[model samples]
Target chain A: MNITGLETLVFGVEDLAACRQYLLDYGLHAAADDPNRLLALDGSGVELYPADDASLPSAPNGCQLRLAVMGVADEATLQAIAEELGKDREVHRVDGRLQSVDDAGFAIAFQVSRRQPLPLIGEISNAPGSPIQRVPNQLGVVAGREAIQPRALSHLVYFVPDLAKAERFYVERLGFRVTDRFDGVGPFIQPAGSLEHHTHFLIGAPAFMHGVEHFTFHFGGPTEVIQNGSRFVKAGYQAFWGPGRHIFGSNWFWYFNSPFGCHVEMDADMDLHDNTWRPRLAPLGADASQAFLLRRRDNWMPGPGTPENGDYAN
Target chain B: MPKSPTVPNCHAQPLCHLSELGEGSARGFLPDEDGQDRIFIVCHEGRLHAWRNACPHLAGAPMAWKRDAYLSPDGRQVMCHAHGARFEPDSGLCVHGPCLGQRLESVALHISTSGQVSLADPHLTCSV
Candidate 1:
């Protein structure tokens, strides 16, 4: 039950070429072996197949996400998942990885994690009366120095018909712990092997509308999220929601509309949780969602006629 | 209604000349403060309306999905890009989406004979 993290996301798309181009614009490297599948620049996986691909599994709740592949800490975890899932439904192996469907009918796969520990490059900052993170004359931000790349697949959010059943399958069978919950909504569940607040967040939706709401990738920091999001917007993609800080995971997020029928997000600086941390429960609403939010726009400074300079005082 | 002190008194601070915006289009303005606070004015069908750019559902959620894309394709209502909530151009009332019955904070604007548009009460505050 010690699942590591999300390794890859398999999407069944109507337009292969458009999807491929979108992923390329999103900073994922296309695989030479499979043109439909892509790997994040850091090597996290994203595979896309035609909507009518026979190899794709049937979706239970009519979601576009055909399969969400996760990484296990070791062979023992894969064995445990196989054994636990085998008790009820049949288990299948594809490409040496064990695959099973959750109770809610979402396809999942397990394998050893391809995720590597990324080296940390701290984001520079300066404030009055505070020690500067960047030396004087050293610019903290360098737009377009390097293309913003997602380090790893951070998390995925799903809309489920029955919250209790989905929660039981992941928590009871897959050994995920709930980090937080909202009454009548769902829980933010983290895998046993990961310290992130949540790897999977389930939201209650109508029976026929169960599907992936969105999925996000981790960035180095808020600066990266902002810079990458700006670049993405400049590329002519639609900004769905964000460039704002969330109150739940405390991550800086920027979500955009994608061709995959769901939103794709770039997130950074999420909260970490452990066994000792007790999950908090609260009512969900707009005021409870974000502490601070920002819209990406041109920087505004005092214009030439501002009264600050007494140049245009009436 | 009386103006609140929290809202910046925009009377003295002119944003832009009306000629800078095309008729039936909108432009966003950032106050000289921290730049997070914003307002936008729309010249729709021969009338002008101005409101804070933040959506009612999410405080910092800007109405536009892109720069100055405040109207729906048909150019009828002010649309919130985050969730598809449509607001009336004149009233700023939410006509659809999760934040139904909510309204965008409308800012009082003064249009001078010289064709300049500026905030009427810059000192008035609206809750985030």
Candidate 2:
């Protein structure tokens, strides 16, 4: 399976206007011809449909990821997937795309990658013994700036009632590998085509909670995550988690509450893993979570009798 | 500059002497009587810097694993044991981790001419 990465995600939302605005506020570019489709800065994006639309297929077992479409390296890979999937599960070719359903009931699609190489301006930083990222006049950061756009869809997380069965289907059938595991929790699985730490993370959860936990987009660096997160906060969006680094993938993250009943995250600087790397199992705890956590600051005032009294929250 | 005695009738209090900490060591300082608020002073590359002991990620939980052991194995950066976030020595800017653009709340400090390091202002507090 030469699955490169996430190509697009189809969302069945309740409110069209609100979801469109939410994607825009999150720094995604919506198509002018079809407002229902939202594009990331990289041109790949998400498509939205009405929740009760009959055209949509039923969810496998109450999952938010209505249809997860992935890009393949070439048509040969697509044909290969179609042939392999056709053996037992009924595979359909619709609009030049192969569609099938995994054992867990999540819809899957594969196509020759429409992904393009988008050139983005990189962000820089200054650290001890490292070259200065910004010159004297060129400031690295500013207060209350414009929204930061996301580069591409990084990954998605799913809550599954049967962890063992879900892991087996992805690994044995779809050619995904277990990059890491959380004891009694789940596994971080990556496809054979990409070197990203994990393209999909499966978490063990109750059947009632079986749905998409959250999905994330990659940004330039930590600066983008904080700046974008602050802008989202200022816009009155609730923050779910983050502004911290994860110990497993080593990415800077910030998660925000969405109207879709799931979290949306902006992440940067995730570690790249190869076959040479050995997967380690760690018990998930606060100590095993993020390296350091930051509080959401809108305006912080000092206590009485401080040096100077003003707002330092940004 | 000549050495001056500790000023009386003010909130500023001496934290420790510069010689007390090595080039890569840290100590936690409790500001209020409640003992819930903590500040850690670290010696990074022979310079003194301090930050709130709480990580910005985990609801302001203490960043250290054990008492005052904040440095990574290389002893170059201050690491939060809860999530493995690392911050710079002087600027307290998180170079990599969850709180990338966010900085540690820095407590103003004044080193007296007599080598006494004291809080520049005791009234300063990080709001939750």
Candidate 3:
């Protein structure tokens, strides 16, 4: 199977208006035809519907994620995926997409890739003694030069009751490779058609907690993660965890609570790898997971009464 | 920037009046240094109840996805948007999500006949 990364996710929400406003404020572009669908720079996006909407699939347990749509590389890959999944379960072809349920019972679909190319240049830094450098006099950051937008849909996470079964579904049936593993947690997986470290990550959990853990989009760099997160915080959205870097994929991340029944993340600067890279297993902890952690605080300058750390909380 | 997760200046502070909180609506109060609420009050089934802003699944995790928005979309269950765990608005018993079989810690409140509500144990708010 030549399944690509995330194409779009459909969310069945309670308050359509509030979720709409939340996505709009989260730096997502509005889809012209639908009031609820929001997109990133490339076309990967999320569509929202009312929880009672008949068109949306009921969540496997009772979580908010209704459908997760992955893009395939070609018509053959789409057909192949259909045949592979059709072996033991019902497969439906609705609106030219293959629809089936994974081993964990989450609704999934596949279609020919429609993601357009993003030609924008990402962030570059001028480091000492580095052969590659930015053009002369390009400042590191501009406070209000341009609006920050997510480049594309990055990855999704799920809380699975049976980690082995869930991992087998993607790794065996869907042609994904395990990039890394977290003991007592789950694995980070990459699809066959993409070089991204992992388009999906699974976390082992109880049956009642079975649902989407989080989904995130890629920004340009750590600057974008922090700056965009700061802007989001300024807009009154609640921040859950992050504005920090992870060790596995080396991606910078910032997570925020959402009405979508799970956390949403903004990430960037992920390490790309091929099958040549081997998977590693490590215990999940603050030290093993995060590279470092930082706290947000009011900007201040050193003064007579200034704390020794100068407003630094961590 | 939010201060430490501790509730600040809870002594003699009136959280909100009954008039400010309509029935079936939730409101949070006493933001710590970080502007994050320390406790939230909900009016459910014609009665008033208060709970710590933190969710049971994760320590110090605020229940709201945004400022003072702590209830589910239907205004029935008090929701922790961090992972969609919901609790009874009156009993604080989690009915769904990651913290299943858990309960949100309740905060005691003193509601006077005049409709003013204050922390019954102000010291509780100052810890976390």
Candidate 4:
């Protein structure tokens, strides 16, 4: 149960062409060309694969595959995992990655961490009350719109029927810490090696929901989230939510509906904390996450006679 | 009793009283459309903005449970409770989240001076 880190995301997509185009436009570097079997990578070597090929490992029609790579501090850590998990489940080695399934039926994989140091700008900010908020303005000239290069694959979410079993398997076995919880609802748990509020979130359901809920990658700033999101939209992908801040991870996010039956998110500036941060356990109430919620709006352009003639919509 | 097609549909039976939605709080209504329940309107910011409550992400409903749809602290952006997605209040633009640049089906409203609310295009079918 002691997971080292997130390795890669494997998706069972219906339309590989559309999914490939969506990921490419969303800024992922393509690694393969086959329509059925494609791979994409962000800066951190987090591989995004479309599981259209029948060769890939997949569950029955209503199941999902989650591959969480465990960081073995050394051979000892790997041995420890093998000793513990191998006692009950069958642990196989494929492509130098330890592959197994937890009690909850998610195809789990582990390996020596394959993450690289993502080149991301540090501490981006804007002039006070400036139009170019969240980005640095040099001499009244806004810096060129920067493309949001995903730093690292942050997390994955799933809808499961048994929240208790899923929580127990992840928390009791994998050494994940609960950063926050909606009592009787679900828990946001982070891997032992990561400082993100949570690396995996499980939501309760009566049956396994369609597939993966969503996946995200960390960006640098709010501007990156917006610019890259705008770029993805202009390229003709469906956006699902966000470009808003989450109270939990405190990251600015933009999520897009992918052809893979789940959402992909571009995130930036997540608040990182160590074990010292106390986990919050709140009852599943109306206002559990945010202080309040706003309904969707579409008025992006400033009204006529607004300051500086800054109507973004032409 | 058979449900009226033109009447706005909400999730919970008998649309939430206009007074129940505070100045900033919004409620999602799922109308029973031809035996299939559909999310119809969101009452927020003192305005009734209607959309096909399906989240563009996987076509899942945006709210997790009842009245759990997203709202920003400043009351500006309505976020999808499921995936942390956001939408602008006035334009229904998917400003943030998985549905970037996409928009919810905006149901035009006809507000009477006396404060009654109804669909602006009564003839339009709810086909989203």
Candidate 5:
């Protein structure tokens, strides 16, 4: 059951208009729109539907319904997946795509190929003594005003109660491999074709609401996270957490509150690995998960040793 | 004993001792002159600062819900618990979360040797 890449992300939003506008403000291009549904594209497509819309599949709060399309080297590959999946679950054909529900209740969709290249910003580095010295400059001078474009849908996270069962289902049945693990905590599983840390993450917990934790896209660098994050703040959007670096993927991130009861993150320079890479298993602790946590600082004042007194000259 | 008017003017008096506000905590006070809502002040680093309690994001009242406002674990950032937006305490600039690079409104404060806290807006103080 090998999956290739993320095909589409489905969300149940309260206000279609507001959600649509939020995505547009975040720089996603609206390619298709109707009264009940909207398909937004950002180098890739994101499907949005009303919370009570019956035509679309339903996911619990904090759970995400992911469509992992298979990268078939040939037509025979698609036929193989359909044949294998059809043996156990009721596979439905819709809009020339193969759909089925996995054991974990996530609606899975398989297709030949639907992903397109995203307009990613070029790599940039800061010179010595620059304010953004350690961080990469993806957003450049576009902070606090324009929306920074998202490069690609990077990853999706899900919280599940039973990690063992979920792991078995994805690995044994769907051909996902455990790229890494948090000791007894959970496994970071990736599809055969994906080079990311994990395209699909299954966290362990109790019987809880299943939904998307957060979805992310690759930005050019840390500067983009700050620039785009400031832009969203000025636009009256609530920021959740971040513009911080995470230890897991080692990507600089900024998370924004979305209408979908989850967060949308802007990330960049995520570590990639191949089969030769050995997975590290560590306990899920805050110190082990994040390299550092920065608190908000007063940007209005100079440093403690600055010559100018605490007064600012207008 | 009868309670004073629901709206007590803090400006009529010079400075009030507000002990309920802990270090790095903030509370709203009635307007001093114009009846506008002003914020009371305290910061983690012992430096006093004040500003309107309203969060620019969604015009939401920040710290309205107690236990939702505080400095992050590191004590260098101000964290809004509702959405996890972290602001740099000194600069008021949001370095992480949704409001990156945007700053909170900074209000000037003067702390006396007797622990009396006074609001000192340069514009209002100059005219006086």
Candidate 6:
């Protein structure tokens, strides 16, 4: 399978107005013809519908994520996926896309990728011995840069009841490769066509917990992640986890709670792996997952409000 | 006489006007250092119920998709959006998701005749 990565997700939300505004405030552009559909820079985006909409698929576990639409490299790849999945289940062609469901019962679809190539460079560092450096007089960050847009739909995580079955379906059937694994937890996988560590992750849980865990978009880099996340917090969204770097993918992350029953994450600068790499397995833990954790605080200086203990004051 | 259970020191903390929380609405309060609420109140079916913001599934895990969004979208159930655990709004019993069979920690609430809603005992964290 020449699947590139996630393309779009459809969510059935009870409060469509709030969900729509939330996506727009999170920097997604409202589709010109359809304001309810929002897109990122690469054209990967989300479509929202009322939870009671009959056209939407039923989420077995009552999750808001109703369908996942993946992007493949070409029409042949899409057709191949359709034929493969069509063998044991119903695969329908609608709106030039092949729609089906994964082994774990989540609705899925495939389309020939229409992602627009990004023209900008990622955030650059001024390491002493590094070959790439910003031109002289170029500031590391500009004041009030344009609104940060997520570059692409990065990945999706699913909580499944049968880990082995889910992993086999993706690996053996869909040709997704295991990039790494968390001991007693799950595998991080990427489809054969792309290698930004993982485009999907599966966590094993009981049947009652079967649902989407989270989904994220790739930002320009860590600065964008922090800046956009802080802006989101200031806008009254609740922060869940992150504003930290992950050990496995080396991506800077900040996760926020969404009206959807799962988290939405901003991620950047992930490690890209190829066939030459081997998977690493480590115990699931805070120490193994994140490089470090930090909390948000108000800006301060050693002036009027400084305590008698000075900088040492808690 | 049997010995009574020792209790923590308690103090009254006024929260908000009863009219502030509209029927079928929720709000969070007492933000900690990290800006997470330590407790929340829900006005459901014309009665005010309070619970610690912590979800039973994870220690100290605050339960809101957004600030004061402690209930599901339809205003029927309390939801810990951390993992989609749904609890009964009036009873605080976990009805779905990871913490099945568990219950939210409830706090006693005192509503004055003048419509002041306060913590019955702010320091007395009680289990449901």
In model 1, the clashing pairs are B6-B125, B7-B123, B7-B124, B7-B125, B8-B122, B8-B123, B9-B122, B9-B123, B10-B122
Error of 5 at A161 (Å): 2.5
lDDT of each: 0.77, 0.75, 0.87, 0.59, 0.60, 0.86
lDDT by residue for model 4 over B31-89, one digit each (tens)?
Answer: 33111124445555566676666657546554321233345434567655455456876
Which lDDT tens digits does candidate 2 get at residues B1-128?
Answer: 22122222234567788788787888776532212237888887777898887767556656653346566545788766544467886888877655766788787778989888877775443231
Top-scoring candidate (lDDT): 3
Q: Model 3: clashing residue pairs?
A: B1-B34, B2-B33, B2-B34, B3-B33, B3-B34
> Which window of ten consecutive residues has the lowest lDDT sum in model 1 chain A?
A305-314
| TM-score versus the correct structure, for each prediction | 0.70, 0.67, 0.93, 0.64, 0.64, 0.92
Q: How close is candidate 3 to the true structure, as a TM-score?
A: 0.93
lDDT by residue (B64-110, candidate 5, tens digit) is: 22222245534556655444456776677777544667777776676
lDDT of 3 by residue, A152-203 (tens): 9999999999999999999999999999999999999999999999999999
> Judged by DockQ cut-offs, is candidate 2 incorrect, acceptable, medium or high?
incorrect
Report the C-alpha lDDT of model 1 over A158-262, residue by residue, as the tens digit.
888888999999999999999998878999999999999889999987764477778888887898888888787777556766789988889888887566656
lDDT of 4 by residue, A160-228 (tens): 667888888888777788888777778888887777787888878545252467877766566666777
Model 2 lDDT on a 0 to 1 scale:
0.75
lDDT of 1 by residue, B15-124 (tens): 77878877778767763232323677888777778888788976666566445667765677887655456788888888865477899888887788998877676544
lDDT of 6 by residue, A167-281 (tens): 9999998999999999989999999999889999999989988998899999988889998988888787888887999999998998888888888999999999997889999
Winner on lDDT between 2 and 4 is: 2
lDDT of 2 at B86: 73
Q: Worst 10-residue stretch by lDDT in candidate 2 chain A?
A: A305-314
Instruction: Report the number of the highest-DockQ candidate.
Output: 3
Badly placed stretches (over 4 Å) of model 1 are A124-138, A302-314, B1-128
